[model samples]
Target: MGSQELEEEELVQMVRDFIESESPSSPSFSSSQGLGTFNQQPNYLTLQEILGSVEDTEDEVHQKILKYLRNKNTAWKTTNLKKWLVMRLRMDGYDASLCRTSWVTTYNCPGGDYEYIDIMMDNDENGGVGRLIIDIDFKSQFELARPTTSYAQLTDTLPCIFVGCETKLNKIISILCTAAKQSLKESGLHVPPWRGTNYMQSKWLSDHCQKVQPIPRISSNNS
Candidate 1:
């Protein structure tokens, strides 16, 4: 066989290996037991739970979410359940479509204790762009009062969530930075004037909303 044939054979074998093998890193929410079991009062709180953010499970990194909060089965209202389902999808590795009324949560990975805070976006309806979910694991924690289950950890990583297109998601890191600031505000948290909620501009803050902060671009080696 020629070198080209050998390369093709290797690719085929690799594909087969992936199809047959399951990696431990991937998440599977296979439990329907406690899911959507919350009451009028939504129980528990995760960054996603609080924010109502969406994500695409295809690229979502759910493992990064703290373990305990990930498996939360509750009896709650349908409205709240909807929110919970949307958040779980982001952390798990599936993207959701908010515009599609039929796009409800799927329990493909049932039997999970908890979920994450990722939001799915409507590309066509809301600027027709994509969003990115980033869990910013903190290198350090705060000394003040915070959610013990959440803020008690030694490292203080901010769960970063933003919406945009591939090119758009890239151009607007600054916008995402602003959006994070807005997220904090929307959740009734205080921030600096510049760090205020971008959602303040609802007209400007739709599904695939993109807003570049007025801050000038600085070339960071890491960025």
Candidate 2:
């Protein structure tokens, strides 16, 4: 066999390994259950449940973000918006900061990086630390080129701005990835590896994430 043939063989084995690894670990509503027994909820109910489950601090931070967006200047870019939000949250006495995660390419997945806002808070009851994730365009992450009615409805239930804990994010990613694979199959399209649940989870759940405070840009005229 030629060198090209060897490379092809290695790539094929990598994909097979990825498939095997994803099987038994796929998440569901509960850790002990599987997606087979999962029930789909109506869009409104799903959103309501997600929004209602947040802690008081998370809900307050989410509302602040919404109001910030409503009064945002059209000229502000996404990066600026995040910086401003982080600054505002810190001023308001929240431990909010910008977080970015990057992963290297593996045989079964491509390398990529993602940035989002995270707030660290001390749990009052347990006296433990908790982290709340805030993704500005959370819904758009799972969008497909073409989708079945059911898949579209499922994605519609995702919040535009995701404000939840790690556990909640994990459950949502699992549900969406399962639906996405089905939707692609029904549309006669191949499901890409990046759309896998593992890949989605890596964006936020990876231990390699870097957190930092964004400095507010000073006007040149101020000098």
Candidate 3:
């Protein structure tokens, strides 16, 4: 495997290690509780609640990140959004050198094309530098030529995608869903019926990532 692919594998291994270490070995039950009874589900904060919490944070860096993301116009541009995200990641304790924007990697597509990753992060400490590619969608309307690669081609190429994110502001989830379905047609993957659900899009993108070749991280030392 190339350096980039090796890096990604290392990241996956690290995640597996973390999960394994944190997971409980066995379920613990109390004799006093009835057998039929179950533990109450933990209350999770909703998206709005999480955003509200960030907005109300006393930390300067947290507030700055939230303010930057809340800027509607700035968030619409992929370049601007990437810069802000990289900054936020740095503030959140990620290695700045590992996070890159406008990362270019050549793929042997139909006519030989280049894939520009909006934001790529290589969190692995190994010698390899395979990054996790993240694609951001901010367009309010879906265009036929939205992606440089066609839906038919994406079935063959999009598997390298690590994450696909859409802006919460002024975004129509239905339009995004339509685009996703078109891309998955040739890949033999199916989009969930609930197009509006975030989980559906995440699952689809993740599935695509699993199918494509791993995109290697560009060497920073090489100009």
Query: Against the hidden reference, what TM-scores do the models get?
Result: 0.21, 0.72, 0.23
lDDT of each residue in 1-223, candidate 3, tens digit only: 6785564455334423433432233111101112122222111112212212321111333233334444433443333334445544445543322222121222311111112232333435675533323323212123233332443222221111123223421122443445566655645565444333343333222223322232333333211
* Residue 60 C-alpha lDDT in model 1: 36
| Preferred candidate (lDDT higher): 1 or 2 | 2
Ranking by lDDT: 2, 3, 1
Residue runs of model 1 more than 4 Å from their true location after superposition: 1-54, 57-122, 130-150, 153-223
Q: Positional deviation of 102 in candidate 3, in angstroms? A: 9.3
List candidate 3 stretches off by more than 4 Å.
Answer: 1-68, 71-79, 96-130, 138-223
Off by over 4 Å in 2: 1-52, 72-79, 214-223
> What is the model-wide C-alpha lDDT for candidate 2?
0.68
- Candidates 1 and 3 compared: the better one by TM-score is 3
Instruction: Return the TM-score for candidate 2, rounded to 2 decimals.
Output: 0.72
Over 1-223, each residue of candidate 1 has an lDDT whose tens digit, in order, gives 6785564455334323432342454222111123332312212223223223334432333443222123342412223332343444433434532221111122321111111123344566567744543222111111222333322221122222222233322323333344444445555676533322222221122243332222222343220
- Local distance difference test, each candidate: 0.31, 0.68, 0.32
How does residue 37 of candidate 3 score in lDDT?
21
Error of 2 at 193 (Å): 0.7
